[model samples]
Target: MIEKTISGQDALPNISDAERIFAELLTGLAAAQPGFPLAQLKTFVDQEFAQIKHVLHGISLLGQCPDSINAALICRGEKMSIAIMAGVLEARGHNVTVIDPVEKLLAVGHYLESTVDIAESTRRIAASRIPADHMVLMAGFTAGNEKGELVVLGRNGSDYSAAVLAACLRADCCEIWTDVDGVYTCDPRQVPDARLLKSMSYQEAMELSYFGAKVLHPRTITPIAQFQIPCLIKNTGNPQAPGTLIGASRDEDELPVKGISNLNNMAMFSVSGPGMKGMVGMAARVFAAMSRARISVVLITQSSSEYSISFCVPQSDCVRAERAMQEEFYLELKKAYWSRWR
Candidate 1:
């Protein structure tokens, strides 16, 4: 082992000649700054210069690729972002294709020697900027169209876009990397004891989406759900950590309901009627009336062949829906009864 002198503590174990070199890098960095944030300092080390088991490991850690990868990342127009993204994936030895502005689809297609697929981006870009295995989709942006910039999928579009691209590629599963480990009964940032769900069905994710789960977009599941593509939500922050899987994995001894996702602005409606028993199309009529008024329903539950039924809707539309329901389904309303609005 090479000899090295240090002024501070020997915190790192299994010191090696190469490791000592890396260790000296830290000292050199420290010599430049006596007071540096632990987090930021560590980030510089882990990000810029860390010992690698393999060259590929170094590439993966750098988030770059040697040739190319099968996956594609859609993001809004930002040359710096693209450059940085390319750098990271390139380090990981992945060939990343950056597609921007919806307009680039055709060009990317023509150049790649492939045809554009609308339902999903499944074109072979043999001559394109990206590789043949790469895909197409909108980039992640809040909302709106940017000129010359690739389409922003909007809100949770990246997640949806990745799923769709994965579908086009027919990948076994799509793993979403985020800051948190996985889905919990409540936001882990909020509830410390928020239980993590091992697995969740599409319906459950849908319910959560309706209740404003930031993890997924509502439109995402329907397409993939058509093909039943399972998604794993993993924490980009902690790679080795176990994340939650969203699929049809039902645990026999698990909670009948894995998690409870609640929408904040909700209005409850209670519709009751003895005459409504075995109601022919009363349920349908209630919804139809609300539809006419453009009122949205959130949750609903009814008794079996009974006179009473209850549902929830947007709090803002409660009065309008209630009035509509009361006016249309009045006869059934009198015998049984209806109350509770918002």
Candidate 2:
């Protein structure tokens, strides 16, 4: 029997949890299925895998990541779950590091000796400056308003955390592992034959994310776009599936509609005024302050006249934004353009 070797750079990139599982799968096959040609043997899953290889067909990572390359995982506090994932990646000969976002988050979590609140956990996960080539983030749940005082990334923060981390690191791309096979044009849960998109532009994915396809985090596209990072939404549950790709690089074969992503518990705000009208850098100043406060902008729209820019954000950030506007733009706040949809 011919022996196939997987090592060094070739083995490094495929060391993620999903890919490691694929290795375990191969081992099982070699043991139980015996006498098969193991050398030159390849693992091919659904049509999705074929598409995945095709997408990366031309793109190269300089040279595959070295076998001993490292990755960093950030979580709200120290988590066994993130630690476990880090271990999985490391075993495949990768160097992995796990960082608890901040001291406060960890101190409270450590006191619990077991569990902690999700929002404080996510807020504490701002990406680190130290580099690890690859970054992974996790979400304990889907959504939340922190202590009823701030809107946290909520349910899908893991995905957002990944994107945010990628943006921070300026990595080549981010790969998010979820349960679903990939991004479907329609909810496969609703429609059995829903078409899967091979690739989608950031704008298309963002629009779909707003609708309901859960592959990309609804709140992550902005950070991703800011740096033009590419993301692959693949299944951790089914690593063989062909996952969808999101980013600007899919310049070819772009589609008008990609997938549908949705947000529940969303709030909208509308503002209009002559003060807002003919305003110089008014919207920029508003958003800048929100960014400074670590408030995330969810959705936004402006009047045809450019008089105002109204945006939706986590319910938690609303009050902070309002108070900031009041204190900084008191005259504008008194006669400010403002309205909302809860």
Against the true structure, whose lDDT is highest? 1
Across residues 158-190, which tens digit of lDDT does each residue of candidate 2 receive?
Answer: 566566556655679888888887788888877
**TM-score of model 2 (CA atoms):** 0.45
What is the per-residue lDDT of model 1 for residues 67-98, given as tens digits with 9 covering 90 to 100?
Answer: 21101112212322344444445445565666
Clashes of each: 31, 17
- C-alpha TM-score for every candidate: 0.51, 0.45
lDDT of 2: 0.54
RMSD of 2: 17.6
Name the lDDT of candidate 1: 0.56
In model 1, where do residues sit more than 4 Å from their true spots? Answer: 1-130, 133-137, 141-155, 185-191, 198-214, 248-257, 273-279, 292-295, 303-306, 316-342
